[model samples]
Each structure stands twice: as structure tokens, then as C-alpha cells.
Target: MRCPFCGHEETQVKDSRPSEDGAAIRRRRMCPACEGRFTTFERVQLRELTILKRSGRRTPFDRDKLARSISIAIRKRPIEPERVERMISAIVRQLESMGETELPSSTIGELVMKHLKQLDDVAYVRYASVYRDFRETQDFARFLGEEGLNEVLARER
Candidate 1:
């Protein structure tokens, strides 16, 4: 592998092991030219997937982008990082197992919303506000009421 630190042509792997979640392989490497050490993760891609956007545009599916969006929703919401990672892995696995090369963006969004609802209400609302494009306070009220979450929120207080 190419060394990220000094742009060396090759690096030696000092150690290799499965990650905590077992979704990826973690490798520790050292660059001979600069002796810089860094960690890398390798994941298996079952196939190349494409995202069918709402606007009739197709784009390659990006795991990092999905992780970033979930991170934004769960930021400071008391959810464990390992749980978030597993959630992401589960979502990806579900998508891949569907046996389709292309999938609607809504599918991914709904999956996220579903998982967030089970994970945390605040994170769910945070993601829904953006995904559903809430325009006013009434939107949240309507959503909470429609989803029968107001009672849950009230009970918590």
C-alpha cells in the first residue's frame, strides 16, 4: 500500500487484524522511507452499487457519506459509536443483500430514519427535520403526533 504520510511507494504492514465490529480488517503499516506509521481499514464490497437520486441523476454509493450523515444526526445524542458503526454496517448489508445494483435515495433515508427512531428520538427528529424538509414548528408537531411519539416524549418528561 502507498504510504499516506510521505507519499512513499510502498509500506510494510506491521500488524493485521479484524476490527472490533468484524466488518473490516485493520492494518497497521510503517513506511520505510519516513518510518511513518498509520492505520488503514479494508472492507469487502460485494458489488458496485448506484444511488438513484430524486432528480433523475445516478451516483455511486458512498459509505463515508452515509456515515457522515448519520454522524451529524447522532452528534451528542448519547448513542454509542460502536452502535452507530453497527447500524451503518447493517444498513449497507441490507442494501447489498437486496440484489439490486441501483436503489432509490429514499430507501437509504427511510432505513436511517427507522434505525434512528429505535436508537434515539432526538436523533430521529434531527434527521427527519432535514430529510422531510420541515418548514415550520408545526411540521415537527404534526410528525410527532402522526408517529404517536408525543406520548412517549410526554412520558419521558
Candidate 2:
């Protein structure tokens, strides 16, 4: 690696460790010429996965987009940032393990709902409002009844 401080041609790795999330490796390096030290992170890039929309259009699966949507639902909730990152990584890993390059948008939404349901009821409801395209209060009422969420809500109240 090139030294950032002195722009030296070579640097030696002093230490290496796996990141907390295990998504990347963190390396500590030293520039012998300047005696400068720095850290670098390395991550593995898997094959690109595509989203197969209902309209027959295809687009690359975007992790940021997924995070944004989930974050919206989780707004004002008590979920930890680490938990959110873990959830996103888990979903991506699950999809990648399926051995399919292209996946349906519905599949992604369902997975989000599954995780959200376990994380927080309010977030799940908020996400379901958008994902299921809920129209009226009756839709929520029906959802609560069908999902047996009525008891959970009552208990929380």
C-alpha cells in the first residue's frame, strides 16, 4: 500500500483485524520512510445482483436504497444502528445464498417485513403501509386481525 502521509511507494502492514461486523478487514500499516502509520479496510466484492421489477425491468440491487427504506420505517424507533446494519447484511447474505442473480422486488419487500416484524411492531406497520400499499384504516384493521397483531398491540397499550 502507498503511504498517505509521505506518499511513499511502499508501506508494511503492522497489524490486521476483522471488523466488528465481519464485513471487512482492518489493517494497520506503517511507512518505513516517514515512520507514519495509517489504517486501511478491505472488503470482499461479491457478484452483482439484479432486481427484477414487476414491470419486467431490471436494475442492480442497491444496498443504500434498501437501507434508506428500512431507515424510514425505523424512524423514531429504538433500534440500534448496529442492529440495522446486521439486518441489512443478513438480508443480502440470504439473497446471495439463493444462487439467483435476479430477484423479485416483492421478495425483497417480504424479507424486509419479516425482519421488521421481529424488530418493532410500529416499524413493521409503517413499512407494511407502503409495501402493501395500504389504502385505508380498514386495511390496517384487517392486517392487525389477520396477523394476530391486535393482541400484541393491546398488550403494549
Candidate 3:
């Protein structure tokens, strides 16, 4: 690794450890010339995946965009951030395992809804309303009824 302090071409790793989240490795480095120490992180980059939009457009898969959508749906909810990250990772893993370079937008939406349904019913409904493009109040009612959320909501009364 290059030294950041002196812009030297060579640096030695002094220590290495897994990050707190276990998602990456933190490495402590030292510059031989300036004796300056610095830290760097390393993470794995999986094979590139593509998203096939409804418009027939293909775009590179974005984990942050996926996280933002889920976060918006679960906003103000009780779900933890770690859980959300795990969910996104699981979804990405599943997509990658399919051995397909491109996947339909609807398939991705279904996967998100499936996971959200288990995480939080309200969040699930909130996401479904947008994903399915609910047109009226009855659409919400029907979805709640079909998902047995009506009964779940009743118990909270």
C-alpha cells in the first residue's frame, strides 16, 4: 500500500484486525520514510449484478439504493439497522446465486416484500402500497385482508 503522509510508493502493514461489524478488515500501516502511521479498510467486491427495469432498461445493481428503499419503508419503525443490512446482504446473495447477470425489477420487488412482510407488517404494507401502486383505499384494505394484516392490526386495538 502507498503511504498517505509522504506519498511513498511502499508501506508496511503494522497490524490487521477485523472491523467491529465484521464486514471488512482494518489494517494499520507505517511509512518507512516518514514513520507515519495510517489505517485502511478492505472489503470484498462481489461479481457485478444488473437490474432489468420495467422499461426494459438495465442498470448496475446498487446496494445503497436498495437499502434506502427499505429504510424509507421502515422509517420510524422498530427494525434495527443491522437487521436491514443483513436483509440486503441476504437478498444480494440470493440474486447472485441465481447465476443470472440480470434480474427483473418485479422479482427484486417481490423479494423485498417477502422479507419485509416478515420484518414488520406495517412496513410491508407501506412498501407494497407503492410497489403495487395502490389506486384507492380498498386496495390497501384488500392487501391487508389478503395478508392477514387485518387480524394483526385488530389485535393491536
Candidate 4:
């Protein structure tokens, strides 16, 4: 690595140790020319994630927005906030680990639906109503259709 202080192209690593977080390596270096020393952090490059929206627009991936949406779904519910955060993080990690730079928004929505479905039915329906845009009674009916007909009918009665 180039010496930050001496502007020299060569530097010797005087000491190397693992960072406390273990996410990166902490390296102490000495410049041969100016004898000025400096420290550097090194980490592997992660691939950038791209989101292909339904509107045909491509955007950089964002975790905060996903968390916001999930939080909104579970707002005032019995579910724990940290649980929602963990679900969002799990979904993001799954997508990032796929080794793909680009992903469809539908894929993200499906992940959220699958996770929220497992967490709470109210949250799942809340998220689905916003994402799927149930415009009419029929639309909601069809969405509810995906659930077990016997269970829903039993709930009604």
C-alpha cells in the first residue's frame, strides 16, 4: 500500500492484527523514505446491490427503507421491534449472499411476505395490502384466497 504521509509507493507493514470487530485487518506501516508511520484498515470489497423496481427504474439497494416498511407493518402490534429488524436483516443478508448484483423488487417483496407471514398474519396482511395494492373487494378476496379456505371460513363463523 502507498504511504499516506510520505507519498512513497513502498511501505513495510510493521505490525498486523485482527480488528476487534473481526470485520477487517488493522495494519501498522512504516514508510521507508520519510520514516513516517501510519495505520491502515483493510477489508474485502463487497459487490454493490442493485434493485430493479416495477417502474423499470434501477436503484441502489437500501436496508433502512425495508426496515421502515416492516416497522410500519408491525406498528402497535404485539410483535417486538427487534424481531422485525432481525427479519429485515435476515432478508437483506439472504439477497446479498445470492452473489447477484441486481435483483427484482418483486423478489424482495416476496421475501418480506414470506417472512412476515411466518411472524404475524396481521403484519403480513398489512404489508401485502400496501405492496400488492388491493384495489377492490375482489382483489382482497383473491389475496385472502391464498390462505386456507377452511381456516378463514372457520374464523368467520
Candidate 5:
């Protein structure tokens, strides 16, 4: 691997192990030229998946982007980081096993909604506010009512 610190051509792996969730291989490396150390994660990609957007534009699926979106939704929530990581891995694995190279963006959003709904109600609402393009407060009320979460949210408040 290339050294990110000094732009060195090579780095030596000092240790390797499976990630806590067993979805990726975590490697500890050191750059000989700069004596800098860093960690890298390697994951198995079953295939190259593409996302077909609503705008008719196609783009490669990005795990980081998905994680970031989820992170935003769960920020300051009581959820654990490990749970979020596992959820993201599960979503990616499900997409890969779908046997289709190209999938609609809506499919991914729906998967995220499904997982988020099970993970946390607050996070689920946060994500839905954006995914469903909520224009006003009534949109949230409508969604909560539609999902039968009105009573639950009222109890929390």
C-alpha cells in the first residue's frame, strides 16, 4: 500500500486481523520512509454496483457516502457506532446479493429507511425528513401518522 503521509511507494503491514464485525480485514501499516503508521481496511466486493439516480444519471455505489448519510441521521442519538457499522454492512451485502449490477437509488433509500426504522425512531425520522423531501411540518406529521408512530413520538415528548 502507498504511504498516505509521505507519498511513499510502499508501506509495510505490521499486523492484520478481521474487523470486529468480520466484514473487513483491518491492517496496521508503517511507512518506512516517514516512520508513520496508519490503519487500512480491506473488504470483499462481490461486484461493481451502480446506482441509477432519479435524474437519469448513473454512478458507482459508494459505501462511505452511505455511512455519512446514516451518520448525519444518527448524530447525537443514543445508537452505538458498532450497530451503525453492522447495519451499513448488512445493507451493502443485501445489495450485492440482489444479483443486479444497477439498482435504482430509491431501492437503496428504502433499504436505509427499513434499517433506520428498526435502529432508532429519531434517526429514522431524521433520515425520512430528507429522503422524503419534507417541505413543511405537516409532512412529518403525515409520515409519523402513516407509520403509526404518532403515539410513540407523543409518549417520548
Candidate 6:
């Protein structure tokens, strides 16, 4: 690593620690010539996973977009932020483990919906409504029927 102070290439790592992310390494370094200490972080770069959209377009994977969508579906709910973060991590892990560089948008949606179902029923319904693009209450009814939640909704209704 080049020293920012003197632009020297001679630097040594003084300390190394694992970052909170556990996927990254944090190092405290010193430029031997300038005696300046600095911190550096290193993380593994994964193969880029592209999301093939239903619009027939392709885009790079975006975690922020996923998080935002989940938050929207979970709005006004009692779900915690940590749980959402954990869910995102779990989804990413599944995608990565598949070792596919390109995946359909529907795959991502299904992964989100699967995990959401385990978290909260209302949140699951909310996510499904937006994700499945339900145009009418009947669409929700149909989804519940398909997912076998129809019997429960019927009892409540």
C-alpha cells in the first residue's frame, strides 16, 4: 500500500483485526519512512450476479434496492431492522451459493417471499401483494388460496 503522506510504497502492517462484517479485514498500517499510521480494509469480491428483469433487461445485483423493497413491504410493522438485515444476508447467501452469475428477478422475489412468510403473516401478505402485483382483493384471495392461507382468511372473514 502506498503511503498517503509521503507517497512511499514502503509500508508495514502494524495491526490486523477482523471487521464487524466478518467478511472484511481491517489493518492498521504505518509508513516506515513517514511514520504515519493509517487504517485499511479489505474484502472478498464476489462474482457479479445480474438480475434479469421481466422487462427483458438485465442489471447488476443491488442490495439497497432489495432492502428498500423489504422495508416498504414491512412498513408500519413490528419487524426489527436487524431481522431485515439478517433476511437480506440470508437471501444473498442463497443466491451466492447457487454459483449463477445471472438470475431471474422472479427468483429474487420468491426468495424474499419465502423468508417473509416465516416472519409475519401480514408482512408476508403485504410483500406478496406488491411482489405478485395483485390488482384486486380477489387476487389476494387467490394467492391465499394457492398458498393455503385461504382457509384461515375464510375463518376470519
**Top TM-score: which candidate number?**
5
**Each prediction's TM-score against the native?**
0.95, 0.76, 0.75, 0.66, 0.98, 0.70
Give the alpha-carbon lDDT of every model: 0.93, 0.90, 0.87, 0.82, 0.97, 0.85
Q: How accurate is candidate 6 locally (lDDT)?
A: 0.85
* Candidate 3 accuracy as TM-score: 0.75
lDDT of 5 by residue, 17-118 (tens): 999899999999999999999999999999999999999999999999999999999999889889999999999999999999999999999999999999
Model 4, residue 104: displacement in angstroms? 0.6
lDDT of 2 by residue, 1-157 (tens): 8999999999999999987789779899999999999999786657789999989999999888999999999998889998988888888888888889899999999999999999989889899999998999999999988898988878766
* Candidate 3: tens digits of C-alpha lDDT, residues 51-140: 999999999988789888999999998888878877877787787788888899888899999999889888898999999999999999
Cα lDDT tens digits for candidate 1, 1-157 = 9988889999999999998899999999999999999999999999999999999999999999999999999898778899999899999999999999999999999999999999988888889999999999999999999999997777656
Rank candidates by lDDT, best first: 5, 1, 2, 3, 6, 4
Arrange candidates, best TM-score first: 5, 1, 2, 3, 6, 4
Q: Which residue pairs clash within candidate 4?
A: none
* Candidate 3 lDDT (Cα, 0 to 1): 0.87
> Residue 135: error of model 1 in Å?
1.3
Worst 10 residues of 5 by lDDT: 148-157
Instruction: Give lDDT tens digits, candidate 4, residues 1-157.
Output: 8888868999999999976645458899999999998999775436788999999999998877888888898887788765775676678778888889999999999999999988987778788889998888887678778764436445635
Candidate 4 Cα errors over 4 Å, as ranges:
1-45, 149-157
The residue-level lDDT of candidate 5 at 7 comes to: 98
